[model samples]
Target chain A: MTASGTPASTGPASVPHLDVDPFDMAFFADPYPTHQRLREAGPVVYLDRWNVYGVARYAEVHAVLNDPATFCSSRGVGLSDFKKETPWRPPSLILEADPPAHTRTRAVLSKVLSPTVMKQVRDRFAAAAEERVDALLDQRSFDAITDLAEAYPLSIFPDALGLKPEGREHLIPYASVVFNAFGPPNELRQQAIARSSPHQAYVAEQCQRDNLAPGGFGACIHAQADAGAITATEAPLLVRSLLSAGLDTTVNGIGAAVYCLARFPEQWQRLRDDLTLARNAFEEAVRFESPVQTFFRTTTREVELSGATIGEGEKVLMFLAAANRDPRRWDQPDSYDITRRTSGHVGFGSGIHMCVGQLVARLEGEVMLTALARRIARIEITGEPKRRFNNTLRGLDSLPVTITPA
Target chain B: MPAITFIHPDGKSEHVETSGGESVMQAATRHGLDGILAECGGNAMCATCHVYVDESWLARLPAVAGDEDALLDGTAAERLPNSRLSCQINITPELDGLVLKLPERQV
Candidate 1:
């Protein structure tokens, strides 16, 4: 039955309700158990605190993402309905937009970040990875998050985006604001906005065409605008989209891969045995520990999802991380096996709105892990790993680890 | 049902039948066929599902344009005259006997 026709007994009142605050700090630390509960609860559950519908199972999440016409992004991929509330900043052109507006901007960004462009930057990225690994291996032990994960992306990405390096540290806290603003106005969200306010101007300035270096991704975006593909006004917003969405995700993704290999020594052994598995290992890590977790989509109209009827304009939270671990779709879903075929995993999401910068992220992960795998024989956890708390991103703040040279 | 033959890098071939309208990438992935990544989920954004159409059947497919044309240049395998992103080629009755040669690697 179509959602337009209300299925008896599947009304809002009958929907399974969860009392848990998904944005709570405790929940962010270990979301797996809660994810399990959400998956088991039902396909569409009511989050009483937020008054939003949540879809956790793989089939349901996949269905919601694929049917973009129903579960649209233009209304804002967060708690705030763009149709009702004014966005804190200008809404993202690509991330928060539906087609054909998304189509034009996406075409410009995708071509700019195309694999051909990635190939040109590869050697530079590889050298950076090697040098970073050399320095870290010399230490033998260090916090992987600060020293490796966060350090590696920060070293290459900003320069690649063609931003001036002076105020580059603003990228992370700024990313925290971008992702956190997607959740309810909790302490984390407020703190992120406050902490990042100081550096917002620097970020905005970097997105300008004149500020970007020639031949870099940012410059390429502006070039597209000059070519009439995208407008001059749309160009900087696209560049800003890159700055806001790009950095922190890659940092967290790299961190997740390292943390996974350290925790799963056997997986590390497999990667060490075949350094070529570095790319696949990184892909598996993304699937195992999805960094960009839940993204909310507002329903364009009434929709019947997994037997539940969702009203028009209702908020539907898609648990992408939870879907990655849904057993209904994957065998031994919780295990981190690098050899596993993780192609279909929603680590970078699915459908038209899938992560546009994934190729870049993969290259970053591949080179870093490949360099480490070639030189480091073992990755041992040296101390307690401190998890970084963000409303949408899941990763470590500090992951202490000791590496043994091969 | 239209049958699609997938020729692996090793020359091993497998035929999968599916209803019309889904892209070849969708059919290949659904049947768990080897070597079709469809990494960007059939958006023509990623060229991981690159395949070489059988020489005789190349003309049956639609002319590649836009994103598909751009991404094809960066496929892991050498881009042949018959090279196409499988995601752009929709399954149809005319493609019932279509044959696609899979690339050696899709990264």
Candidate 2:
């Protein structure tokens, strides 16, 4: 029974309806107010226009992400339900799948991304990070988004994937389009589609074994196919999965940290005192300003959370950014304190389908932030940071920053 | 500080000082004892921190509850009788010399 004593299985007519357009520019730029409204509206609020259910509270969003069997991600974790509409492209081998298929694919990807493998790649990442930091520090004034956040990942991740440097510019827009397409086909989605075709072709061509370097993540995934862990055709799609989900999140995450540090310079000072705090600082920033903010999960069966009941196959939106700052789950939620034990914040998500490349993302963050802390004594925002909106991802369009060398 | 030993998939082991309140996964990550991803950063959500508790230390730790039990099913390595998510096991005085054998990989 709900706190309000509403029957758990009440139909759409009796449900509390919210008419907010979460995809609009206003909501995308500043969503906390709407998120608060959604959370206060009820545990389960019906979005009348979208014909979907929305949950912004931490407990509800975390619970839904964990109980994948009840709230399925296989049907597409986007506004459009995969069951009702045909997929725009072949679904991600890992992201858009469920067990036992998910089980097999996840096992393969996880092992490939496990710490054992990730360790060998770190020193290389750190060295590149230090080099990038030195360059940025020398310049002192640069757009953190394009100069570092975008440039760093674009250079390193593709090299790690054994992607040829030629046509590498496609990674950012390719990922942007992929993430943007997750929402309704609004102007943003339409624009992304128009800009994405060439980049998508480059990514597709790069996924082939001969096109990839022999020892990269792409080739490692193909080796699994040779071992009969997955099919030959499935190999390229898995590489495509890494390209789609990995790079953009890391770019935005680093961007978020730069933005956070610029806003909260004291946190940056704490990092200067102790460089070990890089990963912790990054984790806290993710908690404070989540990059991949929201995802949709389709209900597999009738379910009641808090008070609202959602029927099977209906889209349920989980506001991850909202969950990260839910006052019920956090103390002084808006403040970004590096000391906060920010793990389990749903920033990298939770449960079976968590971000497969989170470790890599954290590694990138640690490298960049730690490198900066070692050299830069202070940070100043030379101009206002601009917001880049997508249906699911939160990132900066550009952040102009000037650093003072230690 | 009480120290813990982490054994990687290749059977390599390293001992690192473990803080009283931190989880075993934190000790490993802090000291750069690779193989423990702790991807969710010690959150019970990701089973990447899965390890086989030393038979001697198994019963001394708290019984697995919550999401740890379910997440075990997602590990890339085979789940054994002494299997546990290290993140669920907080370091303490009684468990000073905790030994955890990380799986071949965490799914």
Candidate 3:
């Protein structure tokens, strides 16, 4: 579509073009290898097929995330042409916006989801996490991903957001589609779209203020609208942001942390010995294995990064996962070490648009992991783990683990 | 342990003894000082725990980096020149008797 042979627009000569085959199963199974290759090949690789420039290195990725003026989010962060596809529902008022609009929406939601306000739900979330872990540990053997990790967030986040129990079943699959839609339309997107159709109405209904529980975050958002902090029209879209971002991300993060601990029993022992490491352990896990792999930003103008040029309006995929592991930034990047004072990691993203729900996510991980470490003597993998297929979310399908109680 | 005083927006001052290794925000949080809310658990991601250091003791604190500076722009209240995210400031003996003015709101 452009002079650089990428689908979007003409990029400068230094930008290396990479044509990513959306259908590649190996790429799907393990994208890290491809990410590594892209990182090594060049700092800015323009994918001709996907019509996007890929920034795999840490510095460039960080730069793109920080400089929102140069790399805008308004053209739609997802691969879909929002003008054409127009989204089955409205775009996320938070995620899909560029500044000024994003600034206002984020300011409103930030207050609603503030840590002080969130503290009200902290004990409830911790108790729920403890209960879920207790139930799973009682079974002795369970799929860590589905039973503990996924179950905990699904049980806690939705109820906290005030979605009805029956209608709430659609949250995960719907969220999976929303994340997958960030990438190119492939079999994965097709599959998710096919699966999500049945629950579309249920999902839409939950976004309405009337459907939200009184005093929950969703209701608070509508209240903010009523108070003129945000427009009434933006209320459901904000609720959609919470629903879309809240659960699956935390599920993957918690699962990844547990998987890392199980793989490294020494780390598990350390956590068991001192439960305070539970918080840092999650941060370390995110640093080691980032759950949200990549998010694309459309370059607003020609920007120079890592001795290369990224053209205007070109989709730049910031490989946060690869960046977290880049040897340029980290020492012993691959090891799962909880004590490794891991701050500044891009797992929750970077710059102004980082994950707003990260506090809640950290609380969930800390509570459950602390509970597990306190009660369980050891965690061992009883069977091979299964990986969930999503273009964006790097998560587990099943992680069979045996918990030996202390 | 290091001693630190937090000056609330209401001009109320509270002093608390904090462990050397704990972040100022954490010490305030552990003491249940109504002000500092370290939302991201001291990852320096969120700017909830905003405070203005007493100008005389400002030079004693570490220089604010670009990241912290950018986050300060998002603070809930009007940010003073010495505005710092309390999470980024760890408790040290050098910071003993350090006075910080808490903002009216974290969000």
Candidate 4:
């Protein structure tokens, strides 16, 4: 399409448009080849399938994320604009919010998940990792996704949130549905919405202040409301934010780390050589496998980016997975080297909207990898890996691996 | 451009020049100086970019506000009265020759 609202003062330029559906299952299965083409197409390319602008290159994506005022997050971080279409659930106080409201909620959540609190949970999380690794050593082969990736977070995260034991099974489904809903109104989104009632009910019930056990993250959030830091009405929504954002992301993140290590034996060896590299190894996996792949930002006004002028109120789909692997930003962008400098990767996103629960995720990843690094001599892929296709997340459904004890 | 000095825990110092509007953490990381991780990329969410503003220059720097205040409590280094997240301090003409002491470690 011709650049529609170009001002007379600026030179006429055609916006690069592509015939691709990013939300399609085929594209989700292997997005990198398409991602490379998108990156090469331009800094900003219009996706004809979704009728939205797509940003694939690192420089543009980083700039868009950083300038939240210009490319706002409030209008639903998905295809459906919150202003135009009603949200399926109450908007997340922090994730879907901009400043002022966001600043207040973020302060409370950040305090709850601060480094000091992480320090307190460190020993207990480490003990849990050690216990799980001890049990896994007995099995010759196992599904990393089910046994290690899913099981570890399922065990620890809920307890940390003080969620009751009975309805814990709904956490993953709830998170999966929440993440999938971020995409278009495709079958995946429809099916997830249709099946989301029970999971939604359970998550909402668990988020209540009375339902949560004392001296936990959930309780801490409610306490923040009690102390006048946030309103009582906002407390449960913040907990809902955590439940929605936390579990499945970490599960896939751990799965991605294990899958990457299993594929790259040399990188695994490096971690084994220097146990200190456990954190770096997990981080590199995040950079290489960017699990929470894409997020949408709405342009607050007419914007000029990469010589294309995007009209006001247009949705710009950020290819976070593509940016993480963009050759312009990363050296050997496709390789899974554990020792690479992974600090700025947008896997956890960037700017003020960066993942609030990242420290918790990092602690989990580092602890699990360290536990395995200490005992496992090698990680061998024994069977075909099953891919879990989703609109927003890139992860595995099952990864069969056999571990050798050191 | 404003010149800034980053003094490591060992007392060794590195001097760098940064353009206006960039944060001290941005300058350090851009110059490839060690210690300031800036994990949150200047959002002040992570305290890995903690630094102790040199006593002489502390009063001149802008006061800490918002997330930077809460995050200072979580720094790997001890939070001194003069402590700051380098990401919060923007470089300017008046702040030339700013001195910042790097912490012992940044986790």
Off by over 4 Å in 3: A1-12, A19-23, A83-85, B1-55, B58-107
In terms of DockQ, which candidate is stronger, 2 or 3? 2
Instruction: Give a tens-digit lDDT track for model 2, residues B1-107.
Output: 88888877787888889777888887877776666767586645457778998898888899888457766765658889899888888888888788888888653
Per-residue lDDT of model 2, residues A1-406, tens digit only: 5996657558565567999988989998788899899888877788987888888889998899888898988899888788888877778878988888898888778767765566689899999998998889779999999999998887789988888778887888889989988887788887987877798899999999998898899889999999999999999999999999889999999999989988988888888999878887898888898999889998899777776667778899889999889998888999999877565689888888888788789889989999989988988998978899888889999899888999
Candidate 1: deviation at residue A12, Å? 1.5
Q: Quick one: best DockQ, which candidate?
A: 1
Candidate 2 Cα deviation (angstroms), residue A126: 0.4
After superposition, candidate 2 runs with Cα above 4 Å error: A1-9, B1-55, B59-84, B88-107
What is the lDDT of every predicted structure here? Answer: 0.89, 0.84, 0.81, 0.89
Which ranges in model 1 have alpha carbons more than 4 Å from their true place? A1-10, B17-21
Candidate 3: give the clashing pairs.
Answer: A7-A51, A16-A46, A18-A46
lDDT per residue (tens digit) for residues B1-107 in model 3 = 67999999899899988986888887887787877756565656667789999999999898997658867876767789989999888788888888989988875
Q: Report the C-alpha lDDT of model 1 over B15-74, residue by residue, as the tens digit.
A: 988776788988988888879877677766779999999999999888998778899888
Q: Candidate 4 on A268-317: residue-level lDDT in tens? A: 89999998788878888888999899999998998888788887899999
Per-model TM-score of chain A alone?
0.97, 0.96, 0.94, 0.97
- Residue pairs whose backbone atoms clash in candidate 4: none
True contacts kept of 1: 0.47
Worst 10 residues of 1 chain A by lDDT: A1-10
Every model's DockQ:
0.59, 0.16, 0.09, 0.55
Instruction: Give lDDT tens digits, candidate 3, residues A1-406.
Output: 5665664433545566666753356776777677778888887887777776788788888888888898877777777656446775577788888888898898777777665665578789888877986797679998998888888898888878887777677888878988887878788877777777765667778989989999888999999988998988889889888888898899999999999999999999899888867987988887787889888877777767776766666777788998988888777887999887465578888777888888788878888888888888988899988888887888889999888888
Top model number, TM-score: 1
